[model samples]
Target: MNVSQIKIENHNPYAVSFKTNLREYFMNAASVEGIPTVEYVSLEELKFLNSQSKDIRTGNITINPEDKEEVFKALNIVDRGEYFDNETIKDAIINPTAEGMRKLVGITDKFTFERVYAQFIGLKNNGEYDISNRVANVLERRFDEIQHRIFNTKITINEHGFKPKEDIEEIKQKNESLETTVQELQAQLAELKAMMVTASTPKKRKSKAELVVETENTTELDEVKE
Candidate 1:
């Protein structure tokens, strides 16, 4: 994939065009790689539009629409921009990157990681730091024990980097397990509610000792009168 090219039309100040060597980011698996896994909108684009236009829109993130409002509130403080909930603008600001190029394709060099890391740290210091630290944190895990449970000898951290397949499988398994557990809990809850409703209905009580004594006394009195 080639680096993305952005074109801003002089005619329409509000609308910006984005072109990438890779396919467009979509909601499904087909465009999963294209999708921005980080912020809602690109910080680099926000800064650019802020310079060019008056009333630059802020909080215009739509990449993660579900939590867009919350994200907007968090990011709106930067560059004194206006918050726009409009879908058109939101869609335009795809994959906001700290480095100004949110979607970088055809990566050739190892320096890309450092550049991304530096930009990420800068943005984080600016209070808009949210990236895939799970990948990074997972990379930090190591085996430092003298004797290992699985292996008799000392275990060391594997120098080999993480593979995409392992991460994908782990995510898939977790999701499936969570879904199954949710279904089971829902079924159990429904059954408990049904049992409660059945138990709550009024039931007839047996005659009390006081009522039986009163009836015997009345019968004795009637016999004596007879």
Candidate 2:
């Protein structure tokens, strides 16, 4: 929760890469011998990493609890050094007039809100979600809204996990219904084909007019007289 620095070491033997369109970092080259090596990354970078992966959370990469100036120096976190006067910040928090304290609070709130907002954006676009309603007091209401949206039964695993037995059963039922419909259609087609074949076959029925014509005509009369 430090406002200044985030120091971490990649314990993996090979380099750990965190790449995105906005930021890419290759951190923690393998340490030599029994000695330890650590790298200082910014809080912003840590946020990005945490949102995308569980490295920081799951103990793959550990962050130092201590705050240091190396965070600002190693990373381009603060573009304007003049605007980020450490002494002034300390004074506002330590020995503040009412206006100074209010200004500091406003700045801190704005920063926190924006960071949480970025997490939401990451969730929407890339399915990288991390919302802590308990830790972030200012963003609790918004986090609750997001949590509801994520935990709704209608949602998929794109943002969160939803693997209820009901969903599986519903899909199975739909498949069975579709199979039944297909079978019915095939039966109807077979019946129609059978009717067509029956209609096309020649019938052996004789008409009464044919018998009267037979009576009028002699059967092989010329040949029989000879």
Candidate 3:
């Protein structure tokens, strides 16, 4: 049978045999026609699949402990409200380079400088640095805010981004237009229905006087014929 003509029959609703029939049908169809298998997945399953795919795409990452410690220390220093005149420390942590580290920390020892630079590189690669992760977090927050605004206030993101103040006006205009169209259609439909009812209903019977006149005319004609 053609794919469109194929039907699933589930006669025993209470029995588990109905599922067996469905399975057999799909298997047989696939074997005979080389049809692709179809499977239903729950939302959780779909989410897991997406996460797996993302992980595969991201691949494996290895973090160096020494680098992690140094990066953590530097971040801690900044967290304690310490300020440095050199932008190199900030730039190095975000996008570390050997030259930048040397200028920022004044580390003339080759081995020490290399170690610190390696830590910065590791942090940058893992997206664990302040610049990247902080920015991502901020953007995520903003998106959540936008979502809340959209659903609660009927605001939509247009070319200019979120316009909470103008959203009400835009929605009102659209609602008014829709209401007007609905009213016009209702009036037109009412008129058409009235016309249909008038056309379908039988005309009222003639008055008794008119019927009597017609009957008398018929009788007179009949008498003349006789």
Identify the leading candidate in terms of lDDT.
Answer: 2
Worst 10 residues of 1 by lDDT: 138-147
Candidate numbers, best lDDT first, in rank order: 2, 3, 1
Clashing pairs in 3: none
Query: Mind giving the per-residue lDDT tens digits that candidate 3 earns over 1-226?
Result: 1222222211111111112212321212122122323333232332333344321111111112233233334323222212221123335446533343223344333332333344444445556555444323323343344444432222222333222335747988999999999999999999999999999999889999999999999999999999
What would the per-residue lDDT of candidate 1 be over residues 1-226, giving only the tens digit for each residue?
1112222211111223332232222222112122322312344454444454332333222324444344335435443223333332222123232222212211122232223333344334555434344333321221111112222222222323322446657988999999999999999999999999999988976578878998999999999999
* Inter-residue clash pairs, candidate 2: none
Clashing pairs in 1: 1-106, 41-96, 42-96, 58-82
Global local distance difference test of model 1: 0.37
Stretches of candidate 2 off by over 4 Å are: 1-4, 20-22, 67-226
Each model's C-alpha lDDT? 0.37, 0.47, 0.38
Question: Where does candidate 1 stray beyond 4 Å?
Answer: 1-108, 135-212, 217-226
- Candidate structures ordered by TM-score, highest first: 2, 3, 1
- Candidate 2 accuracy as lDDT: 0.47
Which scores greater on TM-score, model 2 or model 3?
2
Which candidate gets the maximum TM-score versus the true structure? 2
Error of 3 at 98 (Å): 42
For all predicted structures, in order, the TM-scores are 0.24, 0.26, 0.24
RMSD of each: 19.5, 18.4, 27.0
Off by over 4 Å in 3: 1-163, 207-209, 215-226
